[model samples]
Target: MRTACFIDGYNVFYGLVAGTSFKWLNLPSLIQHIVHVEAPESQLTSIDFFTSGVKPSLASRGSQSKEAQDTYLRALIAKGVVVHYGRHQLEARNAPRFISKQSPPSRLDQVAIWKLEEKETDVHIAISMYRLASRQASLPAEERVQQLVLVSADTDMTPALKAIKEDFPDLRLGVILPHREGTKRTTPGSLKNHSHWMRRLVTTEELAAHQLPERVPTKKRPAIKPEYW
Candidate 1:
């Protein structure tokens, strides 16, 4: 089966790699391995990674964090993963303040905050998936993508999956949640309901085995792994 993967990069980062040693991920290799485990005949044809650039002012490591993300993105590009960039919007907003677990948030007890939103990623992924499915409808059977795999636990993508499942019955859908093994994150029922199969967690061993090399060669200069990563 010819398969295409759509990855929610922001979702993957916070769910799997953040605060972990696996920041330097080899996404294609890891995804291929997982897909093969689910369907031995699957041939990964393409990877579309959707994400927003880091805001250096809000990042924990400031500019270093942004540089690390840039380097990693360059390495991913070198490996043939097509990246789609969304943008971050920083704005002053007001929201209910957190008190205690037992206390409900009251509108009167609001606080000023800097709200950072990642824009257009969900819509982009949905549109891209639907467009691919529509395009495949015109292709020769052998040239069409037989499978569509989504790598995210976000329920926002459920509608797209459901639409594909309804409109393209021949195309198999798969979902891979970015939750790492040993974590207690719940499997999203909506995503699983729309997908033909759902992989619940990614093993640490898989991440350890699929890290990018310290240096990745580019046309201009080599993209090296960040020292802090």
Candidate 2:
């Protein structure tokens, strides 16, 4: 069966950026890397990476950091990963250092921003799952893709996960989480029992060799490597 990989760009970023030398990752090559490690010689259809474009309101972290991010993202596109850029709307975060019920709290002059729901990223993942599932359903019985691999830690995807199974009984559905070794839940036999599915946190070793030789690749992985998709 034809197989495709769908990645939650932020989920992946949060999962891997902890220890890798490079902050950004190569989406398409990362898939090939994972496939080579887990199921070498298998057919790979396409790599879809869903990420938000830089917000116009993005606070400047100065020039050097921004340049690095731009360079890394560009490299990913150059390598063939489909990049989906979306807009960001920052939400208010309650600073722990200060608080109030009715009166205003003191400003420490420290500014911070966060989003409870990164709406764009969530929408992209949901939309992709639906679009691909629908597209597969529209194909001829024998020509349709029956394998989907999703990489994310968002609980938002659980509904989509269940729906895919019911809608496409013949299709194989799998979930891959990006987290460090000690960060994951204690293994259930299912994760171990699942022959065609799994949950993995990204490892530093994999991060170092984002795009590398398929056979006998360098094993000089990082010391605090985290497991990955």
| lDDT per residue (tens digit) for residues 83-138 in model 1 | 99999999999999999999999999999999999999999999999999889978
- Report the C-alpha lDDT of model 2 over 30-74, residue by residue, as the tens digit: 666666556554456777778764443453444544454455555
Scored by Cα lDDT, where does model 1 land? Answer: 0.95
- What is the number of backbone collisions in each predicted candidate, taken in the order shown? 0, 10
Residue 189 local lDDT, model 2: 39
RMSD of each: 0.8, 8.1
RMSD of 2: 8.1
